[model samples]
Target: MTDPDRPVAIPAVPRPKDRPGRAPAPETTSTYRLGQGPLRLPLWLRAVILACCLVEGLLLAAPLLGLGSARAVSLMLGGFWSPLLGGGTGLYPGQGAVMFLTYGLLHAGLLHLAMNMISLAAVGRELTRMIGAGRMALIYLASQIGAGAVFALMQPQAGPMVGASGAVFGLAAALVGHAAITLRRRRRSMAPLVRAVALILGLNVALTLLMPSIAWEAHLGGALTGLALGLIFAILPRRA
Candidate 1:
């Protein structure tokens, strides 16, 4: 074949601005809202938690005022009264199912009150954000009621031990449940959250085992109840 002269080809387009900039201004999120959604939490939940804690504390101290009748008033009526759970130390219960529930509000000491209030402060606010305040209240009540049921079952002849441990435990479980659901729904792994819960549970268990002063039994009972309630809430259909 005869050789033919041909012009060498050259590139046509110019390389335009491919230099990386400051990450597209970071998606410009709108954070300044006049107000948050209605589900954000009304003052009532906060008020109830604070008011209940305060009143319960006062009731606990009322016995020091030479008012021996305070105990009777608390049990017969309401507000932080330890119900006789029919253990070897106390009298037998003579009321309906509410005794279990009633005992939930009754705390043993300032430490008990502080523990519960701290849990409520941390979990209640966040839960109200996820579910509504009404739902949070329901969860708390259900967890307490469930714990009482379990306690009565476990110790049919146990004493009348009272506290908000069950309900707070429920809240803690709900917090874990919420985190799990949120992570799953967002298509993320739950390993971190699970590890966190596991760590907390381990620490608590160890502390209880080491310190005889702590009510390890009540805490365990409450935690189990709360876990059940949290699982239920997670799977149950939300009302429209």
Candidate 2:
């Protein structure tokens, strides 16, 4: 046997290799890619928003156009006519119910009217078609009422809350849900979509905090409700 050395050489320790490199990614915004869709409103949605807007405008202008009162804003907001005006609680049987529905039809100004119409003309139609007119209508009314509830509770003194923003935000939320599912089913990650949505949410939040002109409560409420409804709709069986 060979004589052992004074000290046996120690085996060299191995260092761990670095982790596998991830694919390189470029910096970008997601809303720029996802903020829109195929441009067209579905028929039922088009008919509804358009007809509603027309009726709302007609009613708002009615007093001035017919009764010649510069202060006839009452009709515009859909109120109960006084008993002296030939009604109890100033309302017909369905008039109070109309109040909930009418506010969406009315807007504080022309600009308010146009913005909502554009949104409805774009996304509302698709919602009605994909989910069916009945469910779509339900979502719209529910979104409006939900948003209205938030406004009535939080900002009652802020004058009558108007516009289709609540329902529009609901549509946005629904789209987000649908897209999320689509990506997942394809085994794709939602990082890009999430980041984009986060940016949108952040921007909206910032605006809400900074500006007194926006009704972000309705936006939040509508988005939440819409997301929930969309999730339910996705799992529900279609009616024959």
List the candidates' TM-scores in order: 0.68, 0.64
Cα lDDT of all candidates, in order? 0.64, 0.65
- RMSD to true structure for each model, in Å: 14.8, 18.2
Runs with alpha carbons beyond 4 Å of true place in candidate 1: 1-31, 35-44, 60-64, 68-94, 210-217, 236-240
Give lDDT tens digits, candidate 2, residues 47-119.
7677767765765676776755532464434621222122334235565456667666656556667777877
lDDT of 1: 0.64
Error of 2 at 174 (Å): 1.6
Instruction: Report RMSD for candidate 2.
Output: 18.2
Cα lDDT tens digits for candidate 1, 133-219: 777787777777766666656656554556676777777777787778778879998889989799868977886788654545556
- As a whole number from 0 to 100, the lDDT of residue 172 in candidate 1 is 78
